[model samples]
Target: MINITLPDGSVKQVSKGSNALDLARQISEGLARNVLAAKVNGKVIDATLPLYEDAHLTLLTWNDPEGKSTMWHSSAHLMAEAIELLYPGVKFGIGPDIENGFYYDIDFCDYDISEKDFSKIEKKILELAKEKQTYQRKEVSKADALDYFSKKGDEYKLELIQDLEDGQITFYKSGQFTDLCRGPHIPNTGFIKAVKLTKVAGAYWRGDENRKQLTRIYGITFPKKKELTAYLEMLEEAKKRDHRVLGKELGLFTFSQKVGLGLPLWLPRGAVLREQLEQYLKRVQKEAGYEPVITPHIGNVNLYKTSGHYQKYGEESFKPIKTPVEGEEFFLKPMNCPHHCEIFNSSPHSYKELPIRYAEFGTVYRYEQSGELHGLTRVRGFTQDDAHIFCTPDQIKSEFNGVIDIVQQIFTAFNFNDVIIQISLRDPQHPEKYIGSDENWEKAENAIKEVAEERGLNAIVEYGEAAFYGPKMDFMVRDAIGRKWQLGTIQVDYNLPERFDLTYIGADNEKHRPVMIHRAPFGSMERFVAVLIEHCGGNFPLWLSPDQAIILPISEKYQNYAEKVLLLLKKHEIRTVIDDRSEKTGRKIRDAELKKIPYMLIVGEKEEASGSVSVRKHGEGDLGTFSIEDFAQKINSEVNKLINY
Candidate 1:
């Protein structure tokens, strides 16, 4: 007998060859029926894989992310089988499960596929799924794998096999289809009761633009038809709230081919919104004892080399700018931390001034592919609400907690109550992918974990998602339509200070390295504003709205009173504007509502003589007429209510 430790810390004595499914059955019949996969010693594997030694096992069901991945992965195979049946001689590339669903890249020789064919393809997938074909995993040698794909004339799989080791090769067979894969798949195709092919796009082989572009089919699946129906409904709602569509409709931002692709051009209204967000964060940072700083948009190549960014991300950065001086080159800054590192090195520091916070709304440029760009969310150039905190190692936890408080305050003020935190750590198998001592990495990771636990955050830990220099905590927030977006990040680094040779004088007169904490609550001004536009549906909170109130005149007779009301509201620091156009009161109200103005103050014959104004809230009906002072007080109070941090 061997010992198997369950997630709840129960040790069970079972036969050495017992599989995860057997253990699940031992636990409960209900659990066994729901088990889709298993996490064995932190590695996800097939539930049917035999376990021969003592191990830690966690049974994964539909509620677990790993289980969902396994289901989606199996769904991808179902999709591939359907595609092969629909279009013979179609060569496959990669088909992996993504955050929402699965996508397969296929080189369809002289075949055309589009969204119009989605229904037929989805029907085929469901038909195959009902066959209840078990997903059979077979280990094969590299020579045999090559022979199999070579006989099928699939050069893609042949090329993939070239880089893989012989002994570790495996293939999964489902129904009448077989594919080369190292997989932990669902038990059978029957688990995917519902299927939907979401979209069709073009992708280059291996992500290399020079290679042949293949047709990429994206899809999603569910175990229940009701769940699939609900998901489709959510997709419809998401389409209505898509940031690209809303951004254009609300005149928030735009893109111009002449200006360049992946670069966002902020219109007047969008600029105002961006400025308001910056001002709000500026006030919060000031209160948190942060000092504002500015840095150049480009830096010398050597600066990045010394900071270690050039070694890790040099190719992904914009092409270097060559100068008249021989061999002198500069790059559009890919990150702001390096410049901040140089700033810290500019002067000597003592223990009393140990923690120094530098904040910047720094604009950085990256070389994002045109196909990957999506409005302001993914852009070539964007401004980061970035800040770095330099403190002693002993102060890392408190500083992290402080940063968390700031992030929570910002989210709460913006009415983002549904926030999820993710802790990202380095992959242990690939230590060379990261920089920093093991001791420092452990300390930094532990500090973030402790702080998150102490603060009682809804946090999940993910390995192999960390930055090259450090581990990070990221915030994923759901918008009004339940579409999740990554908005905030906090990272701890012990590498940059050492690279820059930064030092601080301790109380004992000994020199010590200061630990670096990098954070960006907004991630970037462009992306945050885009998410905010979709979250509030362009009906911004009063304080953040570009035009807090609009004064409307019933006729030419009451134009003077409308102007006076606008001036009175402006004098009280409310962003007020007057619609002086000679249009009907109903037309003016409709226009103001379309513009998403928070409030509309109407002036007519009676209001002109009475020296009062009629107030109407956007999306909500009128709140009654009041004097200009009372209206200003009301607006102030409402704005305060929304902005109380």
Candidate 2:
């Protein structure tokens, strides 16, 4: 018998060779029925995978993210089966479960596929799903695997098999279709009761521009019909909130082919909106004792080499610029920390000034492929609200908690209440892949976990998600439409200080390395704005709105009053605009509503004489007439409530 430990610290003695599914059956029949996968000793694997020794086991149900992933991943295989039944002689490429669902690339030699075929394809998938075929996993020798695909005329699988070692190759068979995979799939096709094929697009076989283009089919599946119905509704809502559509409609930001594919040109309105977000964070940082700094858009190649970013991310960075001096080169800066580290080195510090926080809205560049660029979110160049905190090892937990407070405040101010926290630690099995001593890595990871628990965060801890340099915490924000986006991140690093040879005087009058904490509450200005635009459906918060209020005249007769109202609002520093054109008041109101202005003020002859304006709120009806001072004060009060942090 072997002792199996569960998540809640309970242990059960079970016979060796008992798989996760058997363990689940021992616990409860319902749990066994719901188990999609299992995590064995921190590795997610098939529920049917047999255990040879004692280890920690966690049964994954549909409620867990990994469970959902396993379901979606299995759904991809089910989808392939359906496609092969409908269209034979189709060569398949890689198909992996994405954040929302899954996509499989196929080389349809003579057959053409598009969105119009989605209905029949989805129908076939559900039809096959009802057959309730179990997904059977079998290990095969590479020579046999190659022979199987060779006879089947699937070069894609043959190519994959050639790269894999002979003894480690495996194949999964579901229904009449078989594919090469190393999987933790759900038990059977019956788990997917409903399906939707969302998109059909063209993709290069291996993401190489020179490779043959293949058709990629995107799809999602659910355990119940009602769940699928709800998901389809969310997709419709997401279409209405897509950032590109909202960006164009709201006149916030734009892209120009002349400017470049992945570079965004911020319009005047978008610039004003960005400035407001920056100023709010600046105020918060100031109150928190952070010193603001500015850095250039490019840095010498050697600078990154010393910081080790060049070694890790040099390929993704833009091509280096050659100078008149021989062998002198500079790169479009791919990170902000390397420069901040230099700033810390510029001045010597004593033990009295142990913790120093440096903040910057630094722009960095990467050469993102054209296929990957999506408006401002995936731009080639963007500015990060980046900062680094240098403190002693003893200050790690307190400083991390302080930064978490700031992150929480930022989320609250932006109305992002649905927040998910992830604590990523170094992989224990592959210690050589990470920098820093084991002691420091353990201390940093434990500090994050303890702080998260103390603050009642209900965080998820994932091993091996850490950067090569350090352990980290990531904040995933769910927008208004229930779509998750990773926006804020904080990493604790012991490597950079050692790499830079950074030191400060300790209380013992000796030199010691200061641990560096990397943080960005907004992640990047461009992507954050993109997420925010979709989060609120283009209706920005009052404080962040470019035009807080617009003054409208009943007719040309009231243009003078409109101008007076605009002037008064401006005197109170309210972002107000005037619709003084020769148009009807109803037309003016309609236009202002489309612009998403928070407050609309109508000024007529009665308002000119009494110095009062008629008020109407966007998405809400009128609020009678108010004196200009009262309206401005009310608006100011609303803005104040959002920025107390």
How well does model 2 score by local distance difference test?
Answer: 0.91
> TM-score of every model?
0.83, 0.83
Which residue pairs in candidate 1 collide?
none
Model 1 score (lDDT) = 0.90
Residue 176 of model 2 has an lDDT of: 97
Question: Where does candidate 2 have its weakest 10-residue lDDT segment?
Answer: 556-565
lDDT of 2 by residue, 1-645 (tens): 988999999998888888899999999998898999999899999998888898998999889999999999999999999999999999999999998899999998999888999999999999999998888999999889999999999998888888898799889999999999999798888889899998989999789969999999999999989998999888788888898998888888898889888989888999999999999999888888899999899899999899888888888778899888696889998889889899999988897897899999999898898879998899998999999999988789999998998999999999999999999998888999998888888888889989999999979999889988899999999998888999999999888898888999998989989999999999999999999999999999999999999999888888877887888889999999998888888999999999899999998888988999999999896989999999999999999997764
Model number with the top lDDT: 2
